[model samples]
Target: MNKKIEKCAILMVSTDLTQKQIAEELNVSVQTIINWKKKDEFIEFKDDYQRKYLNNLAAKAIRTMDKLLTSDSDQVRYNAAKDILDRTGYKPTEKQNINMSGSLANPYEALTTEQLLKLAGDDDG
Candidate 1:
């Protein structure tokens, strides 16, 4: 592969720069970068770069979480445990169900002006 394309792939995964920024850094037009993205080889390289980059990031995060879990500070350990649980889909959240049947018109239209004002955090007086 060309050095420019290799550099572009590296810049893409290793930094948060936009295509325009990368183009500017590489002294190429944004369209040229867009064209590179459409090419099969460039697409494959970018996909590989992104996959490896994300894997490395996940590994680092896991290592950090492990360290935090073993921390002497109760708050740190608790936070780490909560984060792990949240990421693993073990955290509990309130579920709300709304009845949207044809028989049920907009609830807002049924409310009294005072009730609407109260709901809006304005005094009803």
Candidate 2:
């Protein structure tokens, strides 16, 4: 791969710059950058670079978790703990698991005619 394409891949992941901005910064045409992106090597390089960057960031955040949790500011501690928990897959929303076997008959179909009609807001009584 050319050095410029390598540099472009790094810039694409490490910065929030648009393709036009990157082209201007690198002194290359926007089409050149778009062309490089279509290459398999460029795609692989960008994905690997971004994954490594995020892994490093996560490691750094984990290292600072203790300090953040013990910070003097209540909001800081709360936010830090919440961030850690969220990253660790803790969700505040309710989760319901419904088991669906091959058979269609289940709890939902057990309702009586009146019960189903009432639920549908069609009950006249």
Candidate 3:
């Protein structure tokens, strides 16, 4: 609760160091780090695994967007949607259920998150 403790907690989160790493550096137990999180005062940093996953999702989204911009094919459209889903870490939200009579290449139509996820080569199973 001291200013020094608060500063340390902020520094730990900003540096991408996990709770264990910060604890080791500060000569404290991991439980202390967890306690900070539970109290909503601060939390652990982004571990390598989380960073890698975010990077992968960003790359996938970029590639898919490029494909959509270059090609007007139905497949390309599907790919764009898929990329968005992959980057977002959630299913796409559809506002309507009716299918319109436009080329599937169009991105402004209604498509299920499942369709986009499939196109992006992601596995939900």
Which of the two, 1 or 2, has more lDDT?
Answer: 1
Which pairs of residues clash in candidate 3, taking residues 3 or more apart in a chain or in different chains?
none
Q: How do all models score by TM-score?
A: 0.57, 0.61, 0.31
- Which digits, one per residue and each the tens of the lDDT, describe model 2 over residues 1-63? 788888899898899999999999899999999899999999998899899989889878787
**Model 3 CA deviation exceeding 4 Å by range:** 41-125
Q: Write the per-residue lDDT of candidate 3 for residues 1-125, one digit (tens) a residue.
A: 55535655555645788777777877778887676656533433334434655676877867768768567688877777777777678776755544366424456346687777777888672
Off by over 4 Å in 1: 70-76, 82-125
lDDT of 2 at 13: 86
TM for candidate 1 is: 0.57
Cα lDDT of all candidates, in order?
A: 0.88, 0.87, 0.63
* Candidates in order: C-alpha RMSD to true structure: 11.4, 10.3, 15.2
Worst 10 residues of 1 by lDDT: 96-105
Candidate 2, poorest ten consecutive residues by summed lDDT: 96-105
